[model samples]
Target: MMEDTIAAYSGGTLPGAIGICRISGPQAFALADDLFFPTKGGKMSQGPFYTMRYGQVRAGDGRALDLCLACCYPGPSSYTGEDLLEIFCHGSQAVVACILERAMELGARPAQAGEFTKRAFLAGKLDLTGVEAVADLIESQSAAAAKNAASLLQGGISRPIRQMREKIFQQLTHFYAVCDYPDEDLDPFVNEEARKVLEECTAELDKLYQGFQRGRVLKEGLPVTILGRPNVGKSSLLNSLAGYERAIVTDEAGTTRDVVTESVRCGDTVLRLSDTAGLRETSSQAEKMGIDKARESARESRLVLCVFDGSSPLTEEDRQVMETAQGLERAAILNKWDKGALDFPEMEQAFPKVFRLSAKTGEGVSELCQWLAGMTQGEGETLVTSARQAALLGKAAESCRMAAQSAAMGFTADAFLADGEEAVRLLDEVLGDAVSEDIVHGIFSRFCVGK
Candidate 1:
């Protein structure tokens, strides 16, 4: 409940450089007074808020726990928009545990997972998108992901959505005013103006919705599959890209009997590489199953690297691999270039993006990595990182489109008013305006405790 004071350990793992114990709520300063004493001898709540003060944290029995730095943030200006206290102490498991135990013993409850951010949301400090952005920023794996999350947190996605909502609200307001006050001399609603506004909002929402796939790839690495006949250096190429011996390599055929996956950093982008079993006929049941999995992996992959042995001429197995790669976003890898250069005119003709790389020597690997990274590059536009945001935006876009169609068809304002109102409501849900308590708790639950 909002009436209760909450405390949590907001630091990294034990034995870190420092540990942070955060206490927030109406009784936060009271708990601070009980647990922490300023070295200079004054109540922390008296004055000089937002400044860290050197202090000694004492346990319930009046024994010192640890000498530390403590800061007081008197709210409605703190992260939770409530009275908050943060104690910076040595990051010992025992010390953090003792301090937290003492705070709870003095009536401060343990903070639930993401309760702080949830409190911020309830206190009008953050919108739903911004709260989701907090989780995305914390879980981001790469620089691009982090940058996008930071933008979302800073209102990149929310700002445009809010503007769209405002325009729709204005249109709705005018329509309602004209209808409700037919006796008054008010400006009549223009069908053309309403259509134009709806069209613009619909287009913007569509564009944002379209970027969800790429944004998803930014968060969860692009799925890539390596396909080739046995011993064509498919595993070797995976190892080369992974910068380690991720796949076992042997001169014997049918070495890999399953899909070996690795999420490797290809330049700036992450590639979820699946090194599948060789795509060749086999008498072994397990190897055949593996080959089936290989084909399935290629089908599901965003990019398929069809590898071929440059040393040997085209074989039936290699031709089969090429045939399977048809209609897929694919590239050709003329692997084992160090052995001998052979003119594979068919490979060049079938695949436009071809790379001659010796997986053994790691030659041409950097170029491939750079190219893979370039595939995920954006033009500095805001992206929809959360699936929930994208889904709602998509629905809102469809609603707007339907309403625009009604306006263009010369229908009365009442005909399109339902859809227009639905669009506004959906957008509100996206911004956490009318979302349910369950949804809010579910969103914040994704965060770790003390966030």
Candidate 2:
């Protein structure tokens, strides 16, 4: 590690006794050579890349600091497709600062957020999907999200895009060969062939377009907001579903004065459950704000979980909340099932799909999860798996539509060709043909410096 090496973490264990520094890029090895001194055989520069060696980090005067295990990763196969150096030194604020300051003095600019992985993308080792997966993997809140990210990183998204691109390329080549050179006109782009090709492309594009919603849900997790009057067992239901004390259950109303957000795996999907404050008019500022946040959360949520006490009658506020949640995918959660039937037969009949459960007794949570899974079935099967990708897919689909329309209407072939070219351009945007530096920087800027 040269002077540019940055100590990523100052605390990996207690007593501040271990620090990890990752130095990446062309100068990584050179930077490591500047700080690391071998005791006997040689320095860090003498070792073959990818090998770990025992070494000591030293100051300019050569005063002893901490012994460390340093590893070098040469370019093309390394994490960032550049020379990389990993330094494991004693986790001490002073020691880490010493290493980092030495690195800066030697010439290593601190890696920006996501810079290492961004470099990996720029180096052609990871595509756009893989880059997004790296972000998702680092930020995963549930097992489902983590698994999805891992799959994407392993080229789950790239495979289909590549396949689609290949098929389109073949068709384009066949069309051009026939049109430009009549000698090969045996396989002409007649109406039937054109229609067939167009249909196939349309179907595939539609599938990919429809997949965006599901992909977003899976990646971000369904935001399920629980809305109801206070003391309706919303907290208890949250704790029950999560199998832990995720929310504080209280018999008193207005107990949850603010929204509490938590995530849990509901089968293969990640469910980001929000236990909101009871929805009711209140003069108190905090309570009012809480209710407002609850409404906002409910409005934005993928699923509205409306909770009601089984023993109580429907209140005006409950009806209003239900009306607002109309048209949204909702599940009326009937809590306190052990208490007896709720007074409103109409409410029960109105939401025939209501899920009855006892939050205190841990009953019906599985059934609820099942219903949730069923409702979300087939949603993410074809989702684009990344917000960035979804946008591009959508834009590409629009371009394809324009091209297909132009081709169908006998409009200028230039317009048709332009649309096709636009479609290809958008596809290339996602498949790694060309992207802006500002976008790249903006994306990697989210990463921790040492990444």
Candidate 3:
């Protein structure tokens, strides 16, 4: 339990309708009673738990600061499993500052970033995964992302991990039992059953690992970089997708001399589109630098949109663009389709996924949008969105595979038991059972103050 009481402004900043100030610790109710005078003429310290009271917050000089509502939650039933007080006051910078300063003067220190949630974790109210889900839920950008985070907060990921850990623990215990009682004949099917359990656990971990790719895309928008030679309508396509003038479009070659990035929602998916400088040999120092950046962006992006001019014959610059996109997750765009079609047999053969569209007229753009949206559609599958969880799951899966392989190879029970124990340890870390202090601190640091 925390010895010090902490308070912070949990609501939005000034110039809003209301401000919420929260105090959590053993001294929460006492501080509330000292600072707030209830309209019903009863002390807040003596108020019923989980009940709200109309009150006027006052300063140390007995001057009324503002009319507000105060709610008290007693220890072990509150958000942090400690006594908590919430004040809903008028949204004004001066009012909020005064109340917060008054709280500090009343022995309630300011809450650190994610301190409330950290307290919840320490008090056994929530696990590591649940804490992560709370953060994810706050930062979710799309509907799908919010839905998945909500599912995770409900123990969608933790329940399966706990089950797998129990299975591994059972195997370890059985193996130890067989070794301890050599004279007693154990079931002949024990080894086979253990192997099956390990294999199934490994398969489940692998499935979760595979979901990370789609989950990551849903959580953080899919990175898409547009690459092409000069005057290939890359910027125009970017503008069309963004539904505004995000990039300067012109008839002149090399109009875009730098990377222009924008994010737009396409159905449930968010596409982080980067319109890069035209890829070509340039003498201008700035253009050359931009081309370098374009290549770097292409290398780092998940999807490359290589645009080609359909109104003209394919030049060496176009062929060079195709070469850059080779061996990458990419799609070819035949821009200027309204003008005329070009005979590019080689370009057609190289890119399996090609779309013919005029960025100016917005023709056939819907098909491309549909494809981008389809990439992240999961049909309500529970996914491991956190990198930490995915990495731990990978480690656990590898351990399971090693144990299963050892059992198949007829190795000593000690060797496979060590692998099983390691798997259990990794899974425990995933569920916050055996996590390090540094990892917990790092995870909570991502949260805003008063969360």
Candidate 4:
């Protein structure tokens, strides 16, 4: 356990209904006794460790700060596995400042960023994956994001990693025993069984690594580019999807001279929509720069929405739009459907997934939204959202593949043993077992001070 006691304002913004001051360490209870006086006239350190008591919180000079409730939790049972105290008081900023000042005066230092959670980690209350999940849960913006983060916090990824590590360790143990003692009646190390185990672990790790991109889409939103010529209603489509007038719509062609971005939530999925300038030959330098950016956005995005005006006959510019979006994952959006549709044989061949929507009336937008939401469709499976976890998993999978190859080729035990051991070491780092202190500090540095 840490030697010095630490305290911080665990409650978020102050000046509201309630505020919480958290203290944890060896001197937590002693500091509580000095700062709070119970209404019924008994010390909290005496009995009823987990119960809260009505009290008056006082400053360093014995001046009453506020009337509130205080609770004490003894060591090995609290959140940090240390004696902890919590003071629930009014949310006034002045009151909280005085209480914190008094805490510092009484030998409790101010807590650092994520110190409380780091303490829990060091005390064995949480593993590395759980530590990361705590941060993920706090930063989750949607219900789908929160659900996945909650599953990670509940050991959805760590459990399988631990099981795979155990299985590899067992295989290593059997090989070592068979080589060390030739006279014993132990079961022989069969190459086929060992190869199967390694292959299974490799496949599982690959699956997890593959899901990282989808998890990123869930957490960071999918990138989408709107591509079309001037006067094609691309900006209108952007405004319709955003449910607001995000981009200015005008009857004049080439009104939008730059890319306008807005994050639109289509059901559970979030699309980072970019309404780029219309693609056309222009003399203006600014419009030319915008067209270049539009093409760049199409190259970088996962999906491109190629738009065309359905009320007018297809022009050469429309054919250029299709050619620009060639070899890309794209869909056709025929805008101004309320005005009436036109038949285009080439458009039908260019885009298999086509949607005819009237951006002015918001008709047929829901179908497009539903299609975008289903693009990232691994809902119930475990996903690795952190880049660190995904990189380690990929390396571990490669190591397991090498080990499986050695086993299948009937190589000597030591040949595959080196790769197997490296795989376990990488897996341990993923679990925060063999990680460096610098990495640990870097991971927790992203957390808020109160956490």
TM-score, cand. 1 vs. native: 0.95
Q: What TM-score, to 2 decimals, does candidate 4 have? A: 0.91
In the range 113-196, model 3's lDDT, one tens digit per residue, is 999999999998889999999998998889999999999999999999999999989988987886788675445477778788
lDDT per residue for candidate 4 within 64-157, as digits (tens), equals 9999999999988988889999999999999988999999999999999899999988998888888988888898767788888999989999
Of the two candidates 3 and 4, the one with more favorable TM-score, higher being better, is 3
- State each model's CA lDDT, in order: 0.92, 0.73, 0.91, 0.90
Candidate 3 has what TM-score?
0.95
The candidate that wins on lDDT is 1
TM-score of each: 0.95, 0.84, 0.95, 0.91
Which lDDT tens digits does candidate 2 get at residues 84-188?
788888777777777777777777777666777777787888987788788787877666567777878887767877776665555455455545765543332
Show model 4 residue runs off by greater than 4 Å. Answer: 178-189
How many angstroms is residue 442 displaced in model 4 relative to the true structure, after the best TM-score fit?
1.7
Worst-scoring 10-residue span by lDDT in model 4:
181-190
